[model samples]
Each structure stands twice: as C-alpha cells, then as structure tokens.
Target chain A: MVLYCEICSLPVEFCEFGKSFKKCKLWLQSNNNEIYNKLYNSDIKSSLSKEEEEKISNSLAKMQLKEERKLERDLINLQNSKILIKRIPRTKHKYIVAIANLDLLDPNLFDMKKTCKKFASKFATGCSISKNSEKKDEIVIQGDVADEVESYLREFIDSNGINIKIEHVTERFTNKKK
Target chain B: MFKKFSKDDVHTRTNVKSSVAKTLKSKLVSQYPKLEDVIDEIIPKKVPISLYKCEDKIQLYVVNNEILFYQQFDDLIPELRLVHKYPDAFPSVQVDRGAIKFVLSGANIMCPGLTSPGAKLPEEDWPVNKIVVVYAEGKENAMAVGKLAMSINDIKTINKDTGIELYEYLNDGMWNFRD
Candidate 1:
C-alpha cells in the first residue's frame, strides 16, 4: 500500500507538492521515520538548473503560504459558527426538534440525510432533511429530542475533529399546559 | 472536464450487475493488458461495483467506497488513486517541475512541458486520444490522468499549445470528491 501523509492526504513522496509540506514532513518524520529518512535524506537530484529550481521553490513557497492563510481563515470562521437545536411547541404537549447550521460542518464527512436517518432510528421518531426559513438545510425530528440530539451532535463533531458549540433553544407557546 | 465537479453533480447511483461487472473487467483488461495480472485484486468479484451517473455524462465506477475509474463517453479513465496503485499499467508522460503547479490547477498540458529536458515521452509514438497518466518531474506518484489531444509525433514537432486535455488532477474536484 502507498503510504499517505496524514496532514496533506497525499502520498509521502508527493507531499512536497501539497500545500502543507512542512506539516506533512513533521507528521511523516514522527510517524514513519524509515520512510521519512528515505524520502528526505536521499540525494535525489532534480534535472532543472539552479536558477529554475530556485524560481519553482520560491513560487511554491508563496503558494503554500497563501494556502496556509486561507486555512487559518476558514478555521476562524468555523469557530464562529454554531449549531442551533430549537425545540418548538407544535400542539398541546407536543414539540419538535429542529437542528440548524449543520452545513457548517464538512458535508463530505457528515451527510445530512444519513444523520437524519440515524436520528430517526436512535430516537424512534420521524426525521427528515428540510429547508428552513433561511433556505438552509436542517434536520426536523418529529419529537422533542433536543437534549439527546445536542449530546449526539457534540459527540459527532468531536469525533470528526471539529470544535463547534451547539446551542439548545426551547420555544414556549402562550397556550402551554404548564 | 471535472475541474468544477461536486456532489451536487451526481444524479443517480446504482449497483452494477455482476455480469456487467465481468464485462467491465474484460474491457479494462483489453485497454490495458498489463492490468490483467492484478485485475482480480483491484476489483474483487465478491465486491459489488457502484455506478454513479454524474452531470455532463460522466459516470464514476466505485467499489468499496473508493472510486476505481470513471467513464465519460467511451474511455474508461482510471482514477489517479488507482494509477498510483499500479503505475506501470498505464502509458505515462512526465511534466517538468515548473509545470507541476499549472497541471494541479487543471490547466491543459502544453507541448513544451512534455518535451522539456526534465520531462520524458515514450519512444513509440502513441496516437491521438490515448489515455495516459501524468507524472511530475520529481514525484514518484502519478498526479493526473488525461487524453492526448494530438499524436505524440505532432506534440514533438509542434511544441506549442495544448498537448493533453487533463481530465483529472491532484486536488481537483474529482480527486477531493468523497462518496
């Protein structure tokens, strides 16, 4: 199997071409010392002349720096984003849980439809992916499982290596039994 | 072609019948005879193949959650990951170090990049429309896969303009696409 760098998700030999070369190098050096030595210590000379090599390295370094900055900006934006789980009172003593802002998470890793199905089975309630007033996709659970959903979402986010806050809100109808 | 592809482009996904999978394996073998040895290992018979019909008539064939190859018309273009697994199975061309960034950005391979001192082309002139893996000057793993826009001889003589129409490359939408 080809060894892949954890940081850049590219083959170890091609890490130099990726945006996170320095991080990939550190990760490889710490995880797989044998492969790291073979890749870095070996004198595999390039065919390009000194000036051409220098120019390419300079441009690559600039591009990598830009990519790193973009990554930092995205992380900051993610930190500001939050998932909101609202428990709305429907009829007498009936409530529904609506989860919003999950799209902030990586859609590739977390599928909204799959998560809806999981919630449906986990709480034995009807759940579906629907668009909210803001035209964003949100999961609507048929019952008041806000607390359960909050804990599950926290676990899910943590498992995916993302740090985001989840807030729970309860809507109180004027004609409530309490 | 797949520079801007995303999950929204996918229209439908269905499992390929075992019989159809057998025919696909044979077709792959015919295209790349070298793959005959490891075809079984690459596409195990027991595992089912998932065919994803995407926008622009592109069809991605996935097995065990990883995309093995994709078809856009008649050619069965191997994904870069698959090419990395069996680098020797496909006809390949190299690009100079300076051209690596452009190729990664989904630019068509220029003739000069292929004929440069750092690059290498096969001795035998492959005809136009041949599918080839693209390797960078210093990289061991293949970075892209594409079809030759012109005959190899023409690329050598003309030495200008587009040479290979890059279909997929490292960090492109298709490469980053996760089912």
Candidate 2:
C-alpha cells in the first residue's frame, strides 16, 4: 500500500520517481504530517477542488485502461503459447486440404441435413471438429491421406459410437487437386 | 514490486509495455527457425528454449504472434535438442510465432495423424490449454489452425465458415470474441 495526502487518497508512489516527487512535495507543504500520514495510511477519501478531482479521476481511469490492455496482451500471449500444430509432410499425389469458418453448419445444433460440409470435414480426411465448439469450426486433411486419415480417425472415434459420417465425394480430394 | 501506477508512467502510444516481451521474442526465434528473419529484433519475444528441456512429451502450440512448446521440464538441454534438432516423436516440426499466427488465422495446421488437444492444463486460465491444428489444405508447406475467433453469425457473414480466418483477411479472418 502507498501513502497519500488527506486531500486525495492517491497511491503516493512519488518518492521512487523524481518526476512525481513534486506532487508529494506539494502535499507535504499543505497538510500536517500526522494527519496527512494517517489519511494516507488509511483507505480514506478527502475533499478536492474540481480540478484536483478531475486529475484523480483521470489517473484512476488511465490505470484501469492499462490494466485492461495488460489483460488483453496476456490473453494473446497465452493463446500464442497454448496453440498447437501437428506436422504433416507435403507429399506428391496426395494433397493436404483444410476448411475455414465453418459457415455450413446450423449453429442451432439441431439441424443436420444442411451440415454436409461439416460432416465431410469431420469424417473425411480434412475434418477436425469437436463437440466443445459452438462456433468457428474448421477442417484440414492432406493428400490421399484422407483414406489413411479416415482410418486414423476411426481409431479415435471408436467405442463411443460417434462414427463420423462423411459424404462420399466420388473424386477424392487427391483427384480434385490436379 | 508492483504498485498502483498512473498514466504518467505508461507509454500509451508506441509499443509493448511488458517486460516479458524480450524474453518471448528470443524464445520465438531460437525455437522457430523460419521466423528468424521476419521478427523485428527490438520487440519483446519469448524466452530462449535452448536452455529448456522436455520432461515428458511436448506439444508444439502456434498462434498469430508466437509459438510455445508445452513440455515437462526434467532435463532442459535434452528437450531443447529434441524440439530443435532430433524430434523423435514428431520430426521436422518447428514452432514459431508466424506458424502460430497462421494457425490461429484458420490455416490448416498438420502434425502426425494423431494429436491430443494436449495436456489437461491451462497455460494461465483460458480453456485453450491444448489446441489441435493441421497443415492447411492447399497450403501444404505451411501450418495453420481453425481459430476460435468468430461466431456463427460472423462466419455466415463471410458465407464460408469451413476454415480458419486469415489474419490479413479484411473481414472474417480477424479474431473477435463474441458471446
């Protein structure tokens, strides 16, 4: 906790920085040390002139904004840190495929017929969808790897009875690439 | 020593104010080779990974501005070797800020056919403890992810909601949190 003047219960962090030292000097010149110190030590408020009130409010607002910005920056940092990727080699004959902004699904979570593309991305090689997602689903698969990928997904979705139903695309994503 | 600060001390106009920026920047460079030339040397980066080692299995997480490798710290040097040079589990994969950005932008990020959203732990408090990304379709040389940035309506605005939103993309690609 920092000490402040009885006239304004601001955190008197002025001593550390020469820049703010003048403000502390001013406060000390007016108020008695004991009363000022008591007020500073306690979380008490003091009457201020309109101008002083504006300054204090401005300071508090600026601090709050800084805190929020810090929060956002930290969130970005955390997102950058937690984000993961799986390595897939670029091979011939097989093409890697991915979809963005899953606009094809009925977010109502009840409709299924219009959800063709969603299912394709999920069950098919390029799909990577999950129940935890209420929005912003995407899918990606590489090359003819979909067949192998399909088999791969089969193992993960086993036993729980959530076999991903991929609409058969006669021309595999491999043929479409060329 | 944290203290109640006022705007007088803050540089609101110019750049990152975090002390950890430099640390994160270095770590991004040392860990991800492709980004060495792209990142400005004067920004706060990630810590150097060369000194850290993987205690257990590690996952490579990527986002818009940085990449982080999540691993248990047992023998720091060995893990550095594994992630940098000799990756036994998933070879030839390097994590960086661009790849992370690309992934978060909704590009397809690829790894081994198998990947867990990763360890059940929060990096801080967000549910994004582990993410699943794949090498994007069409863009095979790069890695990307299906971003959790936009909402269903936002995706609909673009008329295509089947992939990650690119950061440079003008409309839907930018990450926006909507309830």
lDDT of 1 by residue, B114-177 (tens): 9999999999999999999999887888999999999999999999999999999987898879
DockQ of each: 0.50, 0.01
Best by DockQ: 1
- For every model shown, the clashing-pair count is 0, 62
Among the numbered candidates, top TM-score falls to: 1
lDDT string for model 2 (A1-178, tens) is 2234332222233221122334554676575566446534654232334675466456545654665578689667544432112223354344444333333222444223333354556555334443224454445444444454445434533544442333323233333457
Any runs in candidate 1 off by more than 4 Å, and if so which? A42-44, A86-97, A105-111, A114-126, A141-163, A168-178
User: lDDT of each prediction vs. the true structure?
Assistant: 0.91, 0.33
True-vs-predicted CA distance for residue A90, candidate 1, Å: 7.3
Q: For every candidate, what share of the true interface contacts is present? A: 0.52, 0.00
Best by lDDT: 1
